[model samples]
Target: MARSLDLACRCAQLADELKAKDIIVLDLTRVTPEFDYFIIATGNSRRQLHAIAEEADTLMEKSGSARIGIEGYDSNAWILQDYGDVVLHAFDPASREMYDLERLWADATRVDWQAYLAEHA
Candidate 1:
């Protein structure tokens, strides 16, 4: 659980560094067994979304996390990077509003990403 939280927070930090908007870390451990957490964020454009996903992939690999799969890179609407325990969603504003993952997973707890990072640091 600690390792999963650390990786999710690190991914969120990377997205924030690249200026991804409304970055959030959702604790889905109790809600779903498929993934432990979800790091969701919005990008200003398709280019920015790609950039965020690319950086996230690199960072996850560097941290010894194996990427399970990636989807929607070409479409650039909603890109999903799956790292087994942690999954990242980089979406444009329109797609974000359209899917509304937050609302769909409303029962999941929102982890205080900054605090988690600081504590782990």
Candidate 2:
């Protein structure tokens, strides 16, 4: 389940474009067989949450990636977008606090977004 560098770079770009706070890309290849990476980020409000999710979708689409599904946007508390190799979770602070993916997927290795983006440059 090793993810390609291109996938990681795309994920980071999406996170950056959305102005996601404390963005972290998690490598789930070794732990979860379902997806390769988890792009998790936080938004301050419902508006921000929706914006971030939509921007990610747009980026994925432009990159020739088909979205499999989307959820939790009704409340804007959390939004999940399935993009085959990558799964994006954009959430409001409260929802993010409630369903902390970092803590939930503790087994998955944490990726330093800054370092990752720098290396890719």
Candidate 3:
């Protein structure tokens, strides 16, 4: 599989496996010069947020993708895992509402879940 597709699949799988709510995939390749995609999701609580982050890390590692860094795991209000091409953001509802990364990056293309999966699959 293509690297980008594989990354997207892995991300979708992680989100589903962890029961991430309101999962959104942002195509940041054009919007941001840094990463290709941003996988953003909300967790019910801090514990779930931490679990999502850790699971994403494990999935990335198993897929042979190196984790660049992780931030905000201690509080779990927002946990960020950098995986070079893709960045995973796991947030509790409060933090999600507070930060509103989705609205912040609204100008970027919001990925169509079906299209994304089909293209990546």
What is each predicted model's overall lDDT from 0 to 1? Answer: 0.93, 0.79, 0.80
**In model 3, which range of ten residues has the least summed lDDT?**
1-10
For candidate 1, write residues 19-119 as lDDT tens digits: 99999999999999999999999999999999899898899899899799988988958899999999999999999999999999998999999998898
The model with the greater lDDT, 2 or 3, is 3
Which run of 10 residues does model 2 get worst, by summed lDDT? 1-10
Clashing pairs in 2: none
Off-target runs (Cα >4 Å) in candidate 3 are: 118-121
lDDT of 2 by residue, 5-117 (tens): 45655666676776778788888888977888888888888887888778777877877777899899898588998988888888888888899889999999887767766
**Lowest summed lDDT window (length 10), candidate 1:** 69-78
Highest lDDT scorer: 1
Query: Candidate 3's residue-wise lDDT over 1-121, tens digit each?
Result: 2575457556866787788888888887778788888888889988888888878878888888889988898885898889888889888889889989888988778776556667655
lDDT (Cα, 0-100) at 105 in candidate 3? 89
RMSD per model, one decimal = 0.8, 1.9, 2.1
Error of 3 at 63 (Å): 1.7
TM-score for candidate 1, please give it: 0.96
Clashes of each: 0, 0, 0
